[model samples]
Target: MLSPAGDDILIIMERLGPVQKKILLLFHGIAAIGLSYNPRQQIWILKQIGREWNKINQQALNRAIKSLYESKLIDIKESIDGATKITITQSGKTKSIEFKIDEMNIKKPKI
Candidate 1:
């Protein structure tokens, strides 16, 4: 019973697989770019995801990070303060763009 846009997003998430989907969802959900700068400086603190996604545990998140890193979907860099920053990579950007396009197309009303 999902809308076309919702279905499109689901398809896109499926293409990215479970772990990447979680990471991407968390990133997009928080409207976050790069790393967070508060108390949990270097850590990948997806507090919302942690609370909302009951099926995903700390170990799952860790594996998702590793998969994203290895696949070049995301990059981890050390800041001047030695804080690790997570950045969406070029491929990730492209995929995001494609997802947006697909979603937009899905949202178009039928004539």
Candidate 2:
């Protein structure tokens, strides 16, 4: 049996699971890379990292972009082609670095 406080803790823990953290990292990373490119362009660079790691598809890509944009990790501008371009925010850069550090820490083997 779980107390109310325990249930709240469980809910918070469930929200920050491995998969959610990875998705957040990937979305920020992608936004960072996009910001390094032409912002006015109709197309954004779609790297193979997500496919390599998780077999990403169109819907997943859309979801990630939407999530990041809503979180203000990236800014979106519509192009003449009616397509959206992404630019990473300053906060996104900081988050990206933090994510990289977290990845390095996780990948490091126990001594």
- Per-residue accuracy of model 2 over 1-111 as CA lDDT, tens digit each: 756754643443343434434555666656566576665341333444444346555576677667667666568899999997677666555555554534474456789
TM-score of the candidate numbered 2?
0.48
| Candidate 1 Cα deviation (angstroms), residue 78 | 2.4
* RMSD (Å) per prediction: 10.2, 8.7
Error of 2 at 75 (Å): 0.6
Scored by lDDT, the top model is: 1
Give residue 34's error in model 2 in angstroms.
11
lDDT of 1 at 99: 53
Checking candidate 1 for backbone clashes, the offending pairs are none
lDDT against true structure, model 1 = 0.63
